[model samples]
Target: MAELKAGVVATLETIRNHFPSHVITTRATATGGAHVIIEDVPLGPPYNQATTWVGFHLSDACPYDDTYPFYVRADLSRIDGAPLRCPPLHSTGQVFPADNSTTDTRDATMVSRRQRDQASFVFESPLSKLIKVLKWMLEQ
Candidate 1:
């Protein structure tokens, strides 16, 4: 297995601490980073599901690299039966969170959010991005 970088490990730890009740799983990437999947994350408000799994890749570059897109369960729908405001699943049947990476057939839908300013990643860690995305999802 590839070893996780210090930044990747530290970011994972932060995520775990913030979502103590949620189950966070990780798989080391070839480049010394890791794939993080947080299970049973509350979808709250407008969403139909009470909770869904959110996953993303933390490249070895870590804080220097933006986390970009995130993934949630594929079947996500609005509670009022309206069309989902977020990006829908692509033709590949998998959510593409990055150019060549996907949610690995977990049947997830991608939330294509990119930090407006790439330089801000130093201040906006992965955990913060995840929280922000979750809040945005809940409000949609």
Candidate 2:
């Protein structure tokens, strides 16, 4: 269990280094694994209904066994005024906060949008080659 948590932390740190502009948070899932929320990236169209948001899932055994494991999902849909069960059970688990030091929601939204756009390009471009390097490091 400790090793699994370590891997989760390491993955979060790696993502933070690679995508510094994102608002990253972590939560303990009911399954005893962790879920990393990349808040601010809106789910487009169909899934954008009041209850759904998109993010990724990280586990002890990832990448090698799970290709394209960085899932873009709308699993954050809210229900009955309560958010989906992604929050940490006991306390906040904010790994990174949106850079809205002035408490401006617009600024935070814009930053998140920009980061999402940049990430899209990076993932689509040759920059994705870096994933190989990251995978190798994770293996080590």
Candidate 3:
């Protein structure tokens, strides 16, 4: 099942004709997946404003097992980013935010960016690989 899923993603690259605008890159490239930043991607409805990134994951694990094989992820994340376009100052003619609203937006954006930068999404194998390792060791 995992192998089939991985194959589909790789096949998509071929189907898309290896279009740069059709792929997205990831921070981790252990599986040699394609990645790109795109603006207009078809998502069924024509009104969707979200950016789309479609790619495949290849299992890099050697001597793979079906139960635990190398897998590719057909994942999409919202690339929602708005510039801090605060109002400009009147006296200084500065491209600054005006009034308390501008200050508030700045504060909120800073907090959000900091939180996002500090946060990470990692799934740790919690079922205990040691148990499986022990079972394999005993068999050997």
Give lDDT tens digits, candidate 2, residues 64-133. Answer: 2221223232232322355333322211222122222223211111101112344344233211423442
**Clash numbers, per candidate:** 0, 3, 9
> Which residue pairs in model 2 clash with each other?
51-77, 51-78, 52-77
lDDT computed for candidate 1: 0.78
Give the CA lDDT, 0 to 100, for residue 96 in model 2: 21
Off by over 4 Å in 1: 86-92, 96-104
Judging by lDDT, tell me the better candidate of 1 and 3: 1
In candidate 3, what are the lDDT values of residues 1-140, reduced to their tens digit? 12333533543344345344554332223343222222233432221224332221222321121112111112321223422223220011222121222232111111011112212212212112212322332232
Q: What pairs collide in candidate 1?
A: none
User: What is residue 57's positional error in candidate 3, in angstroms?
Assistant: 2.1
TM-score of each: 0.87, 0.36, 0.22
Model 1, 4-101: lDDT tens digits are: 99998888889899989988888887789887889998776697889999988898999788886788888887779987763442222455344454
Among these predictions, the greatest lDDT belongs to 1
Error of 2 at 53 (Å): 6.2
* Candidate-wise lDDT, in order: 0.78, 0.36, 0.25
